[model samples]
Target: MANRVDTLVATSPIKCAADKFYNFFKLNMNELVKIFPLAFTGVEVLEGEEGTVGCVKRWKYIIGGIPVSATVKIEVIDDAAKSITFAVLEGDVLLLYKSFKATLTVSEGSAQWTISFEKSTILTPPPELYIPLVITICTLVDAFLLVN
Candidate 1:
């Protein structure tokens, strides 16, 4: 078994205020899914309370035009810091890796927010195959938020 961790820290500029973008992701995730169909096909709350710790959300998505889904349990949600962490409990990613976790942090700027996305995986094949896909998710979200 091989354990590998791939972490990425990136910042992008948005046209909206920091609070607006923060609230949209932290509070209005359902709406976000609706607006960004290219990123997420469906989002269902499977367990616990949404946005709270232990909450599980199953996200249906089409990556590379192939249907895939990931059921993740919310590990941490920090309102003050504007961050949320999700641990993959089941779904497509498990087929390739033993474990996966992703954390996204949004920090306020003058008129933009910087997103720090960190992902860790164990028993995965190659970082090249999965890392870009993870980063693309963040990029898609950023573009989606900026326009809508």
Candidate 2:
């Protein structure tokens, strides 16, 4: 397969540490993001098991109804070093990029979050794929605060 045309590195405005926002964040991350889909909008969490090793949060989203879909299984690897890695499994990313992943590490004294994505999607995505991801992420976080 050919390499994707783009790789985006998005940095968060605040630190990614164990705080109130972070705490509240865990309540429903997978579900919150799916509320924006114009058609299919639901995320089913298949598994959520946390232990001394790390936490595995697996989820998949069904978009544009049942047939059309894009799924994501995220393994949240939390280390004592104050860094977390989100390893994505299955879906288009798994197909185009065998080892697709994203990482969020603590920076600026854990007061800021730096997210870097290593993608293997099409050189020029149809925009639908990435656009929804960003919009969903932003909308979800925004809703988190407003609702609380």
Best by TM-score: 1
What overall lDDT goes with each candidate model?
Answer: 0.63, 0.44
| Model 2 agreement with the true structure over 1-148: per-residue lDDT tens digits | 5543334454444422344334333444554544545533455544554321234444444443332333444446454444444555555445444454554443332323333344454452332354445445544455555465
Overlapping backbone residue pairs in candidate 2 total 4
Over 121-140, each residue of candidate 1 has an lDDT whose tens digit, in order, gives 44333424444554554455
For residue 135, what is the lDDT in candidate 1?
Answer: 55
Model 2 root mean square deviation, Cα atoms: 5.5
Q: How many residue pairs clash in each candidate?
A: 0, 4
Off by more than 4 A, model 1? 110-148
Show where candidate 2 strays beyond 4 Å. 1-7, 12-18, 25-27, 33-40, 50-58, 62-83, 105-132
Quote each prediction's TM-score.
0.71, 0.52
Q: Cα-based RMSD of the predictions, in order? A: 4.5, 5.5
